[model samples]
Target: MSRAITSETKHSIISDFKEITKIRLSVSVVFSSIAGYLLGVESVDYNTLILLALGGYFMVGASNAFNQVIEKDLDALMNRTKYRPVPAGRMSVNTALIIATIFTILGIVILYTINPQTAMFGAISIFLYTCAYTPLKTKTPLAVFVGAIPGAIPFMLGWVAATDDFGIEPGTLFAIQFFWQFPHFWAIGWFLFEDYKKGGFFMLPTGKQDKGTAVQTIMYTVWTVLVSIIPVFGVTGRLYLTPISGVIVFILGLGMLYYAIQLYKKMTVLAAKQLMLASVSYITLLQIVYVLDKFIR
Candidate 1:
């Protein structure tokens, strides 16, 4: 006998759907790509911008859904992920698979309307994230390296979507975020070491949050800081940072570096968590700096 679904139940399911897709993270990804697009475009076309946002969101959401599907069993063991739709048994694998498939097709089709190159990178990001990074998480710490490739794409992707060219400008943008990920995600790995281990994920650099991982975090944070200021030198043609904005970027990088140093000195979960939040603030502020710098100059 079928039980008639209530309005409340319907809302709950819709919420679960959103949760399964990781709407917040996908939205942030779209924002990064749009910033890239805006930086590349001579003049913004609000219509195409809207489409790019939608396309980016769907593609990233699809990748997240696929990751959940692959990690459903593992997710169930971890406290942080155990309540997720897939692990909770609220959404079936087949149902999530169908949604992922639909999203991937829709995303690629919409992105293709921009250009073949844009669409190609979009597809490649999904492939590398799901196929390479997802499965590799449990196998090796090198997964972070693989994951950063796709992670860095959105910033460069925007430039490609706008210009359809792979040049030093985009490459420089990619490098900034590429190095940024080492410390950003390593912080998460440090704080959640036990939680991740419950699910067999060794995300920390040395598979543990030791001095080795701390030293690496500090090294990458330095790299991230250096690259963040490079645009002010005017080498990246499209991305110019005035002296003022360059100082601001440097200051924000220092804020993140401070937390990274704290994580190293304390080697405690609270310090690692603080570094995680600081990394988030660093990236958000850095992106804002880039967009504002573009306009100020």
Candidate 2:
């Protein structure tokens, strides 16, 4: 009976850790980091790749955990976030803090083993996301802009991890993901505007799911599509996209824009949800196209 109880306790502890780190969010961030690393590295090193991924995961996880701890009160007020571990009382704030601190330190150390630039960027991402963006959520709509900086850093962080320097290639990768976030986030904001309002969060640029915000969402979608195709013209230094790939990317972009326009016209929750889905598809497909184009060309 004691052994059985011990096993259950261990399982409970593991579950709590997953909840505290937000495994789903960490996985998504790690995926983007891998995509960026694949695009950046001329010759991939397996060891460096593993380290980059591990570091990226912990860094993003730490940020998410800290954000939850900081926003526990605000989270409890929101329907969407109230069930999270910290807000739901499944985990204590002190435990979350310790987990976040340990993960952050480990992440930075792993990144530093690969390169200082990687560690530096990782630290900056955590600092900005936790220290700056988390609190700003309730203050102003411009918080989205601040939030995007850290959100976009993973893509560039991967590049620096592999190359240990900043250049046009990393810059291009950063631009692509950077512009993509506006539409993606705004679409989510539109769908959950009511829920976000409950937490006093102004995610949309206009602070409402109005035509103005939708227009801006579409504009950023357009910019994301444009920037995504820039590498195809052979001007992004080591990052080159072929003519055929360029057309394919353009079509994908147009598809995303069409949905954005649809959401803008309807401004319904359903439309916003569709736009959110399309935004996710756009980014994932765009990354695949980029990787395929590099190999095929």
Candidate 3:
């Protein structure tokens, strides 16, 4: 009976760790870093790739863990986040903080093995996400803008890891992800307006579900689409996309734009959710397309 109880406890602990780190979300962010690395690398370095994946995951996980610790009370007020490890009483704040600290240290060290610039960016991402973005969420709508900086870094961080240089190529990658975030997050803010209000979060531009917010969503979606195809102009250095790839990217952008337009026209939760999904698909597929274009061309 004691052995069975121990096994159950171990399973529960693992589950709590996953919740604290937001494992799935961290893995997706790691994917973005890997995609960037693949685009910049002349030849695949399995060792660097593995290090990037581990370092990226640890950095993102640390950010998420710290975020949960900082927002424990607010998270408990919101239905969507109320059941997270810290907020739901499955884990203590100190435990989560310790895990976050360890992850942050390990992440920086691992990324440093790739390059100092990569480690520097990783440290900056953590600082912005935990210090700048987390506290600002309840204070103003601009938190999303601040949050986008760290959120976009992972995409370009891999490039810096591969090349150990910060240049136009990585800058363009950063810009593409940066603009994409506004619409993606605003759509989530729209659908979760009520839930966010319960936690005193001013996520939307006007702090309510209305036309002004929808218009901005449409505007940013347009920017996201435009920035994504800028590589075709051959100004992004080694990041140039072939005409065919550019066309495909434009079509994908249009698909996401279609959802954004629908969200504006409908002004419903379903439309917002659809836009959110489309944005996720758009970013993931965009990364894949960029990597494939680099290899094929």
- lDDT: which candidate is best? 3
Candidate 3's displacement at residue 287, Å, is: 0.5
Model 3: lDDT equals 0.95
TM-score-based ranking, best first? 3, 1, 2
Query: 1-297 in candidate 2: lDDT tens per residue?
Result: 999999998998887788778887788788888888888888889999899889998998899899999999999999988988889998899989999999999999999999998899899999999999999989998888888888888887877877888999989888988899899999999999999999999999999989999999999999999999898777888888898989999999999999999988998999999998998888888888887877767
In model 2, what lDDT does residue 162 have? Answer: 72
Q: Per-prediction TM-score, please?
A: 0.97, 0.95, 0.98
Runs in model 2 with CA error above 4 Å? 1-12
The residue pairs found clashing in candidate 1 are none
Reference-based lDDT, residue 89, model 1: 90
Superior by TM-score: candidate 1 or candidate 2: 1
lDDT of each: 0.91, 0.89, 0.95
Number of colliding residue pairs in each model: 0, 0, 0
* Residue 234 C-alpha lDDT in model 2: 77
Number of the candidate with higher lDDT, 1 or 3 = 3
Q: Scored by Cα lDDT, where does model 1 land?
A: 0.91
